[model samples]
Target chain A: EPEVTQTPSHQVTQMGQEVILRCVPISNHLYFYWYRQILGQKVEFLVSFYNNEISEKSEIFDDQFSVERPDGSNFTLKIRSTKLEDSAMYFCASSEARGAGEKLFFGSGTQLSVL
Target chain B: AQTVTQSQPEMSVQEAETVTLSCTYDTSESNYYLFWYKQPPSRQMILVIRQEAYKQQNATENRFSVNFQKAAKSFSLKISDSQLGDTAMYFCAFMVNYQLIWGAGTKLIIKP
Candidate 1:
């Protein structure tokens, strides 16, 4: 089965530093999303991308966060300046389309630790 | 906005026994999708089962099944003859308006 793949399985960055998390969604998927989970917390949606633009974003996806489909197969999330609270597991997911019952395939996730 | 709730924070069942995890959601949309995902120690998200709100019949995958009550806004997962590998954290989620909303999650332990 085809699955979403993410690069940099684990990353450690200092406060005020920048970090980029990359994902390669399933080839045929049309919708891509970024979600984060703080330790012992719920999985929170950060942003959703479709048609080369952001479709929707949550409050957690603030000014410092940006997502790009930089290439045909690469989707990336960049944080301008990482904060200590930004430490968490970032997951990339993709769905075939906007169908009513479509399911998302998620990557193993990148563990970001900010010091 | 849609919200998913998994009331049970933690639960445990003996191997070979049955276990049920409860989930509820608040949504006004007539058409949506519900899903149950499992995260083991590896922290990789795995789809367990899914149900379309428009369908009345429950969805089942082998030993895993769901009881989806659209009227009550309830969706529960049942694991039959559980095995040690079934131990993991389970999350109930809903898809609405092209967005995914997830619950806090329920930690399940299958004791040998």
Candidate 2:
């Protein structure tokens, strides 16, 4: 079975620096999402993308954050200025459709460490 | 706002035994979706099972099953014949109006 893939499984960056976490969602998926989980905490939704536009975003997804498909197969989340609070496991997920019962397939996650 | 709650923070069960994890949610929407995701040490969120609000019958997959009570806003997962591989952090999530609400998760340990 095909799975979502994320690159640079672990990222270390200084505060106030820019960082882009990349994801290659399932080849046939139509909806993409980004979620963050602080160590030992609940996973919080960041943003959702579809049809080349942001379908929805949580309050945590502020002006400093942005997402782009950039290409047919890649979805990237960019944080303009990283903060210590930004350290977390970022997961990228995709679904064939946004149906009520459809389950999103998730990547292994990129552990971002903001120093 | 929709909120999912998993009251149990951690639990342990012997292999070959059964374990049930509880979950509850607060939602105003009549139609929505519920899911159980298991994340092992790898931290990859794997879909274990799903339940739709309108469905009367519970969703089941192999040893994993759900007991969904929409009226009570409760959805629980029961794992039968639990194995070592079943040990993981289990999260209960709610989907409504295109938003996914996640619970804190219950850390389940399967002892040999």
Candidate 3:
């Protein structure tokens, strides 16, 4: 079974620093997404990308955040300036289609800690 | 606004027993998809089961099954012959358009 892989399983940075989280989606997947889960909270959608551009984003995804599929296989999320509230487990997910019924495959998650 | 609710915050069951996790959602759209995702300590989201609103027949996968009540807006997951591996935080999600609206989640503990 193909899986989504995220590098730097854990990341630590100062509150004002910049951070980039990387994800390699499944080879055949066409749609990609970024989600975050604060400790002890429900998962929140951040952004979804397809065809090398953003399809939709949540209010939580603001000017400070951006996503790029710089290549055919790698999707990355960059935070221009991280805040303490940005500390959370960031998850990368991908699916073969954008249908409501399509199941997404998620990565193990990158735990980002903004000190 | 659409919301998914998992009333139970946590539950525990002895191994080999059957356990049920409750979920409900509020939505006006007639067509949508409901899903159960399991997250163990690894924090990986794994799909457990899915139900389509238009399908009257419930969806089942091995020992995992769902009792989906479309009119009532209820979708519950039932784990039969539960094992310790089945222990995890389960999230119920409602898929509309291309996005998934998630519930807070229910933490399930399977004790040996």
Using alpha carbons, what is the TM-score of model 3?
0.97
In the range A1-115, model 3's lDDT, one tens digit per residue, is: 8899998899999999999999999999999999999987878899999998899999999999999988888999999999999999999999999998999999999999999
Better of 2 and 3 by DockQ: 3
Q: What tens digits encode model 1's per-residue C-alpha lDDT throughout B1-112?
A: 5788999999999999999999999998988899999989877788999999999999999999999999999999999999999999999999876777899999999999
C-alpha RMSD over true interface residues, each candidate: 1.2, 1.1, 0.9
Chain B TM-score (each prediction, in order): 0.98, 0.98, 0.99
Worst 10 residues of 2 chain B by lDDT: B93-102
Write model 2 residue lDDT over B43-85, tens digit each, in one string: 7899999999999999999999999999999999999999999
**Superposed model 1: Cα runs more than 4 Å off:** none
Give residue A30's error in model 2 in angstroms. Answer: 1.4
lDDT per residue (tens digit) for residues A1-115 in model 2: 9999998899999999999999999999999999999997789999999999999999999999999999999999999999999999999999999876778999999999999
List the TM-score for candidate 1's chain B. 0.98
User: Which residue pairs of candidate 1 clash?
Assistant: none
The runs of at least 3 residues in candidate 2 whose Cα sits more than 4 Å from the true structure, single-residue gaps closed, are none
